[model samples]
Target chain A: MRIAFAGNPNSGKTTMYNALTGRSEKVGNWGGVTVGSKEYPIKEEYTGGKEVVAVDLPGAYSMSPFTPEEGITSEYVRTANPDAIVNIVDATNLSRSLFFTTQLLELGIPVVVALNKSDINEKEGTKIDVKKLSEKLKCPVFETTSTEGKGLKDVISNAIELVGGGQSAPYVQADINLQNKAEVDAEDRKRFSFVNDIVANVEKREMLSSETTKSDKLDGVLTNPIAGILVFAAVMWAVFWVSQAWLGPLVADWLVGWIETFQEWVAGKLENSPAILSALLADGIVGGVGAVVGFLPLVMVMYFLIALLEDCGYMARVSAVMDPIFKRVGLSGKSVIPVVIGTGCGIPAIMACRTIRDERERRATSMLATFIPCGAKIPVIALFAGAFFAGAGWVSTLSYFFGLLLIFLGALLIKYITGYKYRKSFFIMELPKWKMPSLKFAFKSMMERAKAYIIKAATIILICNTVVQIMQTFDWHFNVVEEGAENTSILASIASPFAILLIPLGFGVWQLAAAAITGFIAKENVVGTLAVVYGLTAFIDVDELEMTGGANNVAMATGLTSVTALAYLFFNLYTPPCFAAIGAMNSEMKSRAWLWGAIGLQLGTGYTVAFLIHQFGTLFTEGHFGNAFIPGLIAVAIMATAVILIGRKTRAHFDEKYRLHRDGKSGAAA
Target chain B: MLLNAEPGKTYTVKEINTDDEEMNSFLFRLGCYVGEPITLISKKKKSCIVAIKDGRYNLDELLSSAIIV
Candidate 1:
């Protein structure tokens, strides 16, 4: 049996689903966090040994969808014909939630209204007669606090009993022409009146929602036009500083020490084996995977902070504060959510774009959000910042700020290229009540992500590193390349061509080019491949390296100046994201043209930015342009000319199309 | 005149004036319709926060302007 969990956004459905199924799907305070539906077998404790599946659908306000994600919910409930519907309704907002409840009842599906967030209502001195509400709606009602797992067992047991049973709706709309807008509106008004009548009878409140409250006062400062922006910047800066500069490295140092010990143990255990076997097993597999895993502390700490922010209900306000500014770039404040989420990862960030109502805005957001350097890129940033800049905090800070600059520039370029004029774009977001962020929830979220990180290291990173090790070890003739003749290996030969193209951006050696190439598979490979190729066991041990002359050893191995290093870092940061993220972009944009154009834009931005940074940095420091300056100039000029030419053509096309529309309007008037 | 309305005051929704039918219906489903008591919780230069049917929502100027009170 499949029991579908459906309701309003942020009503704690996913939390309940996670509890019932023991799956850690994303849950945030803001609306539309879960853009897609998911299903899992109910935990044995909840199902009592019965084979049951729980389907968690995206939230929808009404049967008629407003956004694409909402459509998923309404369509699934209408067609899938689940055995029962567990409508997770916000108890505090029963007046609006029941409007959908009544519609669900009309479908003859057995619905057990999970009155979620009743705890919040109780705190506010709001009382709801659950028995009376159940009586009126003709369904079982269980008051639940999904965050705490309260009343879940009762809700599930009652829902299990209702399976295959009949549900009779107490109030039903009179037969009418549903296709007619006026008829639909009239019926919806009657339905609202029905819900209102029931609410007035069963509910009493000491504090009205409209009245000014303590939270509103907090919002006055946090959502203020100017102050809010500054606070947001400060908050983001603090998150990065604490994770990257302060707490992250402390934890990482301890972890890396363990990894180095393990590598030594493996090397000792395989001392009698073939020379190649020890290098492959101990150095290639363990060292490469260990290098990637060393950054887990940084990523996990960042996740914990973001989870707390999400749980506290500040995400909505962040969007509210950034909305006006985002709108100027032809995107909405809602776009900010994805960009912020992109800081952690790009796949879900692209999925978050489903909440935006405007198609163009949604596509543009997905295209540009990846510019915000995700968790996987943190290792690259840290490696470069430590090796080249003495681990200065400004290096990480500057990367983020430069990323924001690129997003803005990318949005404007896209706006012109698409020729989208001002339309009547309106923004509305439900402001969830603020509360103390749950520390336990944040810790759980962090642990879950850490598990995923380790699993990835053991599987994909392990395989890729092993392959990279072997490819660099042998020539095309299957003979191990002679020492000091590494350039003849297959890996070096294939990467040399791409290296030629990257000379304008500095650091154009085949090894650097190979790392950048594998980066398309996963961003962490940039760090992992470098560790394997350079034979460095620990990039995080930079202070020790500086002491033992290993810092210059690494600089000699990679052959990058400070300027070229920064340029290479930015190039990897802004380039088209990993293939998994590209798949997400394809799914969300659902347009081949938009997906290709997005890739083109990313490639161009990465190349142009890296080229300028390298050449300019060299000019200022050494009083001359970098190598291959003329060829780089020609490449940049060709891209700029292509953009200009495309912009003119798009403008002309829009002019002709709109001119025809205007002529038609005036012709009709005449 | 929602955009020009005083904050912390309740007013009846007179009408929804917009060319976008989907947005109009979306708002209506949220209980912001004719005769519904909508309260202006706060106002900003470009947007305003409003309360409708036990929910607080921030609306942009273009949207609030279309909601006559």
Candidate 2:
């Protein structure tokens, strides 16, 4: 038997589902966290040994969906014939929740109501007559606290028993013309009144929700336009600082120490083997994988902090505060969540775009979210910063600042290209009450992400490093390439043609070109490939590199000046993310044209930014433009012409459609 | 009238004056409809926080101005 959980946004449906199924499916203290429906077998302890599957659907307010994610919920329940449904109602908001409860009951599926967050009602002196409410709605109601796993056994046990039973709605809507707007409105109004009457009879509140509370007081400061922006910036700065600069690096150093010991252990065991075998097994496999895994602590710490932030209900306030600014750029406050999540990983960030109501904004956001450098790009940034600039703090800070600038510019460019007019984009978000962020929940979330990170390292990074190691090890004739003749190797020959195109941006060597090409597979490959090709295995141990002048040696080995290094870093950061992330973008966009356009935009942006930085940085430092400046200029000018032409074409299309509408002709363009 | 409504005071919604039928219906689902009681919990320069039923929501100036109380 499959039982579906459904309810209003932020009503604790996903939380209760997680408790019963023993699976963590990204529960957050905001609406639309679970953007897709997921199913898992209910833990046997709760099911009393019956084979039952629990389906956790995205929260929705009614059968009529508002956003894409809400559509998933309504569509599943209406079409998928689940044996039972658990309607998780927010107990504190009985008046609003029962409106949905009444709608669910009308579906004729047996719904066991779990009045979640009942503990909040207890503290506030609000009371609900559960037995009376059950009698009124003709369904069993159990008070549940999902966060603490309280009353879940009863909710699941009752739902299991009620499987295959019929549900009788208390108040049924009179048959009306569904196509008529007036008729639907009249019927919905009657339903709301019915829900209100039920609430008035069975509920008592000591304090009205309209009154100002402590949460409202905090919101005043946190969501104040000016103070809110400042607070948000400070909060982000702290998250990055702790993860990248302060505590993260401290833990990474200790982990890197262990990795190095293991690497040496493997090398010692393989000492008697052939030189190539020792190199392949010890250096290519263990050393390369270790270099990537050494940065796991930083990524894990950042995920832990982000999970805490999401759990605390502050994400909604942040969205409210950012909406005004984001709106000006053709995005919304909802866009902020995806961009923030992109700082961790671009895949989930693109998935997060489903909550945005407008299709155009959602597509634009997914395209641009990866402009923020992700956790995978951290190793590349650290490599450049350590090798070229003595590990300067400004290098990383400047990278993020530039990323923000590009997001704003990218959004504006997309607006022009898509021919978006000044539509009244409304912004509204439920302000869920605040609570202390759960440490255990954050820890669990952190471990889940860490597991994903290690798996990616062992598979993609491991294979790419071995391939790069082999390509650099032999010439086209299959004999091992002698020292100083690596340029004749297969990798060098393949990357040389690409290197010619990049000469204008400086650092036109085949080795650098090879690393950048591999970046499209995985951003971490930029670091891993560089380590394999350059035979430098200590990118993560920044302190050790600095202490032994290894940074200078690494810089010398790459043959890039400081200016060119910065250009190379930006090139990798701004380009289209890994193929996995592009797959995510493809799914979210659902438009082949938009997906291709996004890739083109990212490619053009990356190339243009790198060209300008290298050319201008060289002009300032060396009193001349970088090499192949003329070719770079032509390339940039061609890209600029393409953008302008596309923008004009889209504008003409929209103008034609609107003119047809104005002239009373059929506006068939839509 | 919602834009100028006093904070912490509850008023009945007179109408939702938006031409967008979808937005109007979406608002109705949240219990913000004609003759329903709504409260202005606080107001800001660009957005206002309002309470409908037992939920508090932040609305942008454009949306807040469209609500007639």
Alpha-carbon TM-score of each model against the true structure: 0.97, 0.97
- A1-670 in candidate 1: lDDT tens per residue? 9999999988899999998998999999988999999999998787778888999999999999999999999999999999999999999899999999998998898999999999999999999999999999999999999888899988888888999996899888899998899998898899999989999999999999889777777776777889999999999898888888778877887888899889999999999999889989998999999989988998999999999999999999999988898888889989999988998899999999999999989999999999999999998997887778876677888888788888888888888887876578899999998868999889999999899888988888888888888888899998998899999988899899999999999978888998898898999999888877777767776344232343455566798999999999999999999999999999999999889989989999999999999999999999999999999999999999988888788777777777697874322110
> What are the lDDT scores of the predictions, listed in order?
0.89, 0.89
Give model 1's DockQ, 2 decimals. 0.85
In candidate 2, residue A396 scores what lDDT? 69
lDDT of 2 by residue, A1-670 (tens): 9999999999998888888888888888988888999999999999999999999999898889989999999899899989999999999988888888888898999999999999999999999999999999999999999999999999889998988888998879789999999999999999999899999999999988989998898897888999988999888888877777667767877888888889899999999999988888788888778878877887898889999999999999999999999999999989988988788899989999999999999999999999999989887887787778876656766777688789999999998888876577999999998979999999999999899889999999999999988988888998998898989999999999999989998979999999999999999899888877887776655454342454676688899999999999999999999999999999999999899989999999999999999999999999999999999999999999999998888777877877776795534332
Interface RMSD of each: 0.8, 0.7
**Model 2, C-alpha of A72: deviation from truth (Å):** 0.9
User: What's the TM for model 1?
Assistant: 0.97
Q: Score the docking of each candidate (DockQ).
A: 0.85, 0.89
* Minimal lDDT window, size 10, model 1 chain A: A542-551
CA deviation > 4 Å runs, candidate 2: A542-548, A661-670
In terms of lDDT, model 1 sits at: 0.89
Tens digit of lDDT per residue, candidate 1, span B1-69?
998899889999999987899999999889899999999998889888898989989888889999999
TM-score for chain B of each model, two decimals: 0.97, 0.96
